[model samples]
Target: MTAIFRTERLTLVFLVLTITAICGLPLLLLFKIGLTAEGSLNIAPLLEALQSRSVLRALWHSLESSALSALFATILGTALALVIGLTNVRAKGLLVFLILLPMMIPPHVTAIAWIQALGPASPVLRWLSIAPELGSDHPLYSREGLVLLLTLQHSPLVFLLVRAALRSFPRELSDAARVSGSGATRMLVKITLPLLSPALMAGFALAFVAALGNFGINALIGIPARYTTLPVLVWRRLASFGPDVLPNVAIISVILALVALVAIVIQTVLQKRMRSALVGLPQAPLDIALGKHRLPVEALLWLFVASVLLLPAASLLATSLVKTYGLDLSLETLTLSNFAEVLWRQSVTLRAFANSTGIATLAALVIAGLSILLGYFLVSRKAGQRLMAGIAGSQAEIAFAVPGLVMSIAFILAFIRPLPIVNISLYGTLWIILIAYVSCFVAVGLKPVVAAFLQMDMSLEDAARVSGAGFGRRIRKIFAPLVAPAAASGGILVFLTAYNEVTVSALLWSTGNETIGTTIFNYEDGGYTTLAAAMSVVVVLATIVIMVAMNALTKKVPAGTIPWRS
Candidate 1:
C-alpha cells in the first residue's frame, strides 16, 4: 500500500489524478448531461432525443457506412498482406511502406486531395479527356463516395495488423503441410487461411471502429453528399447552435459508443473461438514460390498502389501548383502562389503552423514523460499493481477509443468554465486544445512504451537498486536509457497524431488558437480548395519525412517497440 507507493508517491498520485480527470471525469459528465434535464434525474429527454428522426437516421447511416467500409478495407488490406507477407516479393519493405502511406495521410487531407484529383477541373481528367462535363453535379457527392474514402483511409491499418499476424505464422505447420505432398494452393486454403481468422477479424474490428469514429472524411465528403454521420452531425449542430444542443449531442455520443462497444465484443468473441494452436516460437513466415507469377504479381500490386495512391497524389500536387481548384494542369497554368499563400503569405496560416507544431510537440513531450513513469508501474512489483494497471489501461483506452470529435465535446463540457483557484477559463485558450490532445492521445503514447516494458529485463533494474541507488536515481540512470528509444518512438507517434489532427481541433480551436487541421478545414470550407491542397501537400511531405526518420530511429530499439517498424 503506502509502503509500495512511498518512493513513487508523487508519480503514483499524478497518474491516478490524470487518468481520473481525462477519462473518468468526461464520462461522468456525459452521463450527467445525457441522463439529466434541468439538473434533475430524467430519462424523458434522453428518450426523446433517441427517437428523433434525424438521430435515428444518423445512427443507421453510421452503422451502414462503417460496416461496409470495414468489410471492403479488410478484404483489400488482407489481400495486400497476403501478397507482401507470404510471397517472395522484391523490395518488400519499400512496397509495404508505400502501401501504408495512405493511412498516414490525414483523412481531411485525403478528402481534399481526392476532390482535387477527381473534380471537373481535374488536370489529369481533362488531360485524359475524361473530365466530367461542366454544369453537371460532382459524381462523388453520395454515400458510396464516403464509404470509398473511408475504406481507403482504413485499409492500411488492416494491412499492418494482418501482416504482423502472418509474419509470426508457424512455419512448422506449413513445412509439415508441404512434406505431406500438399500443393501450395491447397495448403493455403486448408491450413493457412483458417488460422488467419483471428487476425482477419481483429483487423476488421479495428477498421470498423476507426470508420465509426471518423470525422474528417465524413465531415468534408459526408456533408456534400448530404449524408450525415454521427460525428459530423454533432459537430455541425454544436457549431451552428452552440451549447443549447449539448443534450442532443450527448445522446448521439451514447449511440456511437454503444455501436463501438458491440463491434469490440463481437471481435473478441470471434477471435477466442479458434486458436491457431501453435504457441511456441513462430517460425519464419511461409513463403510460397510465386514461380512465373512473381513479375505479374509485383506489377499488379504496384498498379493498385499507383491507382489508389499515386494518381490522387499527383492530382493534389497539380492542384497545389495551379491557381484554382479543378483548373486544367499545364506548364503555363502552374504557379506556386497557393503554396506561398499558406506557407509564407497569410499571417494566419503561418500562425496556425506555429500553433499546431508547438501544441503537438508539447503534448508529445508531456505524454512521453508520463508514459515512461506509467510503463514502470505496469511492470513494477508494487502493491495494487493490478488495480492501478487496470484503471490506467481503461482510462487510456476509453479516451482514445471514443472518436476524437466526441472526446472534444466531452472536454468542452468538462472544462468550458473557469477553474476554482485560478478563476481562469481554459475553453478559449491554447490550453484547452492542448489538454484535449493529451487526453485523446494518452493511449497512443502508452502502447509502445507498454510493449517495450513487456520485453524489458527486470534484472538490470534489480541490480541497480541492490547497489544502494534510490528509486528516482535508478529510474533516471538505469531504466530511462533502456526505454528511451521506445519512448521516443511513442512520442513521435503522439506528435504526428496531434499535429495532423482535425476532428478534435475543429471544435476546440478559437480565433487566435487555430491549429493546422482547423486551418486546412477552414480553407476548404471557405472555397479555397487549392489553398487547402497546398497546405495538405506540406503536411503529407512532412509526415513522410517524420515517418522515415522514425523508421530509422526504430532500428536501434527492440523489435516491436514501434508498431509500424516491423
Candidate 2:
C-alpha cells in the first residue's frame, strides 16, 4: 500500500513539475518582462507601447481585419455547412474533405498559393488569355486582400465546427417545425439558425482569434500593402531591431495575448447564454428536400469547391513548373529546376526539412507519451488525482489558447538566459523550438486521449488490480493498448501542425535550425517565389497523404477520434 501511494504521489509531482516548466513558466516570464522593467514592477513599457502611433494603428488593424474576416468566415462556413448537413448534397464526403483541406494546409502555403493564383502571371488566367497585364500592381496587396485571404484560410475551421454541431442536432425540432407548416426557409431562419447560434458564436470567435494571430497573411500581403497588424508588427520589430528591443516586443505580444483572451471569454459567455439543450438523442442531420433547387445548389457548392481548392492548386503547380516567375506556362517555359533546387541542390532547404522533421517527431512522441499518463490521472476515481490532472489540463489549454507568436516570444523570454544549476542556455537552438511546440500543442495532443479514456471500460484495470497488478503493469498491459489508436491520432495531429507551422518557430529559427515553414517563407520573401511554390506543392501533397492515412485508421479508433471521418 505504501509503495502504491508513493508511486501515485511521484506521478502527480512529476506531472505538476513538467506542466509548470513546459507550459506555465514561459508565460509567467513573458508577463513578468512585459509588465515590469529592470526587475521592478512597472507599466511604463505597456503604456509606451500603447501610445506609439504604429502600435496603436497595428492594434486597430488587427481588430478590424480579424472581425471582418471572422464575420465572412462565419456566414460562408455556416451556409456551406447547412447545405451539406441539411440537404441531399452529392459527394458530401469529398466536399467535407476539400473544405477541411484549407485548415490543414499551413496558412503561409495557402497565402502563397492564392498570391500565385491571382497574380498578373497567373497560369490559369494566362492560359485563358485573361491574365492581368504585367506590371499591373498585384491586387492582393492591400487590407482587403489580407482579410480576403484570412477568410479563405479560416472558413474551413468554422465549417468543421459548425458541421460537427449539426451532426448532434435532434430531428424532433425539424419534425416539429415541419408539422406546423413551416416552409424550409422560414423553418431554417426561425428554428435551425436559433439552435445553431452557440456554434455560430463559437466559430466566429475561433475565426477571430485565428485571424488575429495569423502571421502569414499579415506578413505576405499586409507588408506590401503597407497595412500592418500586431503580429506582423512584432515580427518586424524583432527582426529589424533584434533582441535589443526584446522588452518592447514582449509588451506587444502581451497585447496580442490579451486580445485573444478577450475574444475567447466573449465566446464562452455567448455560448453559455445561447445554448439550448434538447431532450432527445442526437439524430442524423436534416435532409431538406431541395427539389428543383437541388441542381443549382449543387452547382454553386461545387463551383465554390473549385474556386477555393482547384484554382490555387492549379496555380501553385503551374508556378512551380515555370522556369521563372511571370513566365508563361508552356513546354518552352516549363522546367522542374525549382523543385530540384529545393529538394536536391539547396543544402539549406534540405537541412530545414530534416530539422523540422526531427523536432516535430520528437515533440509528437513526447506529447503522446505524456498524454497517456495525463489521461490516466484525468480518468482516475480519486479526487486528488482528478484535481491534479484538471490543473495540468487547464494550464495546457491556456498555453494552446495563447497565440503561437506570443508563445514564441514567451519562450524567448524564458530561455534566453541560461539555467540556474545546469548553466545552459536553450535560446538560439532547435531545443527551444521543440519545447515551444510541445507547450503550444499540449492541449491538442491530450484531447483525444482524454476522450478515449472516458469511453474505456475501467473494469479491465480493476480486474488486473484485484489480480495483484501494479499501477505500471495495469497501464502497460491494459490501458495503453486500448488507447493506442487515440494516442497515435493525437501524435499525428501534433506532428502535422508543428511540422508545417512557421509562427512559433519564426523568431526562434536560426541559420542551421531553419524549419520547413520559415524556410519556405524566406524563399518567397527573398525573390525565390518559384521555389516557394514548389515546396508548398510538396507540403500540400504530404498533408493530403497524411490525412488519408489517418482516415485508414477509422475502424480501429473510437468514433469521432479521426476528425475527417464521418
- The per-model lDDT (C-alpha) reads 0.85, 0.91
RMSD of 2: 1.3
Candidate 1 accuracy as TM-score: 0.96
Span of ten consecutive residues with least summed lDDT in model 1: 1-10
lDDT of 1: 0.85
Q: Model 1: how far is 29 from its true place, Å? A: 0.9
The stretch of ten residues in a row with the least summed lDDT in candidate 2 is 556-565
Best by lDDT: 2
- What TM-score does candidate 2 get on C-alpha atoms? 0.98
Give me the displacement of residue 488 in model 1, in angstroms.
Answer: 0.4
lDDT of 1 by residue, 1-566 (tens): 35434777767777878888887798778767877778888888767877888888888889899999999999999999988888887988788888888887899999988876787877788889998887676777789899999999999999988888887877778888889999988987998789888999999999999999998899888898889999888989999999788777887776677678788888889899966677667777867789999999999998998898888898888888987666677788889999989999998899999999999999999988888888888877666865686687688887787778778878888888888899989998899999888988988888888788888888887797678677688789987887888889888989999999898888889999999988999999889888888899999999999988888776767676555667
RMSD of each: 1.8, 1.3
* TM-score for each of the candidates: 0.96, 0.98
